[model samples]
Target: MATGSRTLWKGAITFGLVHIPVGLHTAASEQGVDFDWLDKRSMDPVGYKRINKRTGKEIDKDNIVKGVEYEDGKYVVISPDEIEAVFPKTTQTISIERFIGANELPFVFLERPYYVAPINKSDRVYALLRETLASTGKIGLAKVVIATKQHLAALVPSGPALVLSLLRWGDEVKTLDALELPPAGRGNVSAAELKMARQLVEEMSGPWDPADFKDEFRIQVMKLVEKKAKAGEGQTVLQPEEDAPAHTGEVIDLTALLQRSLKGGGKPARKTPAKKAGAKEPASKPATQKKAA
Candidate 1:
């Protein structure tokens, strides 16, 4: 579970006669290793330079101006003062428009999530709202202006805290009809195929465990980095097993594949590659073993 961090935005939830003061805290963070660019010859850090595309000349910050391209290759430069003049008024309030069933909104509409906490001794009111939403299985549809742009968001209760998830505008979501997909039940799904597929799904179903999911690629990459740093340059590092070759231009037997997968503990075993000629294989230890000094 994520704990509350520094407050990002402060506001009040308002709809009808009800009002609850709250503060929004960031709920998630980006994960993965960040690599910096470097000059290979000098082994020095490399920095990005702003360059004019046509002239291939470096540009300075003062040389740039904000503009909107209303016509092809034609832009109207707008100043910071002009933009701030027309900015949406920051009411610092989440004006909820209506309440709907919690499940009514599609998952696709939800975007960034933030943890909502009571501010300025409004704990009791916050608890009331959270309990009411949890008991009734309802969520609040609200609009808020944050950082300049206005956004539609869903306010719902999760455990002890209220969560406000930013939503995409209706126009932002593409229509499903645009894709030329086959209609439901229009594809050639035989009775036996359907039955087997259902059985496979049922057999594989289990309780949701988020802890079981992990970024194995990131883990392995970091491990490789550690090994290389210890081994220094000009050393060969052992590799992990690669995935089997994908079938190409051949007819696939979906039913047979499902049956075999189900029988073989629901997952296929990976094939280890053969060593190259005259390459002596080292004794295998855990992948995270420290390189010898």
Candidate 2:
């Protein structure tokens, strides 16, 4: 696919021996209708007005400066120059601090994603970092300042390119322990239950594949939108049924459990030697007949 020339954040990835200059480009985008608030009588598009909550009056942009309330009912205004003074001058480095396993970080910590590409003709260095991370099964954790605030990000090998996922800081994430919950409190899981879960898991194993999944809701919504546009009338489409997925009990063996589950559950699988052709033969066998004298 052809890539856009928009650079979200221009920076460099730093490590022990690697200081690869790269630019961060957004890897994804939101696609949908853009709605505007308008004056119904005149059909004039409305622009938002900044209003004071206490006074219930519109405030001018010049009067609405950035401020943080240090005390009750009072805020000290800060200027643009004050904000600019803290901004980082260099927009050419990612500055990797350390490398750690990707799974070590919680999913809640990940906030945003950006594609990292080498600067000018530094493709060689970019490829080196991508390959190194891929081989070692590790992700690079780095701190880079973009705009005014600094961000914590994880550098990961994403297909032919590198992706940097912006992460929430230590103070940003509140631990679940604050809820005063007991150990493994919510889910009523036990040893046998865990074993059954494992059995079900082994039964439904499959290779990692991203192409198999997609945003079905998005596709359907777009289709409805296109139909309305052509018809010149808005119409709602019926939502599809949410079927409960059948989960098999966790089998004892991860490998064999998958094969048997596929056989029993009537799901077609690969024709490997381990995955037999007639997995349901044992279950389908008829009872023995009595012999007549």
Leading candidate by TM-score? 2
Off by over 4 Å in 2: 1-64, 88-90, 146-149, 180-190, 232-293
lDDT of prediction 1 = 0.56
lDDT of each: 0.56, 0.54
lDDT tens digits, residue span 1-293, model 2: 22344667878975434466777654334332233333333323334565554455555554555554455544455566985786564333455656678779888778878766444344554565678788888887766555434777787888897887888776666544323345765377778866866776677688999888999999999999889889889656999997643322212233454456456555222222212111111111111110000
Worst 10 residues of 1 by lDDT: 284-293
Report the lDDT tens digits of candidate 1 across residue range 194-283: 787678667778899899999999999989888878887446679999764331122234345435535655331222111111111111
TM-score of each: 0.53, 0.54
Candidate 2 lDDT score at position 241: 94
Q: What is the TM-score (0 to 1) of candidate 1?
A: 0.53
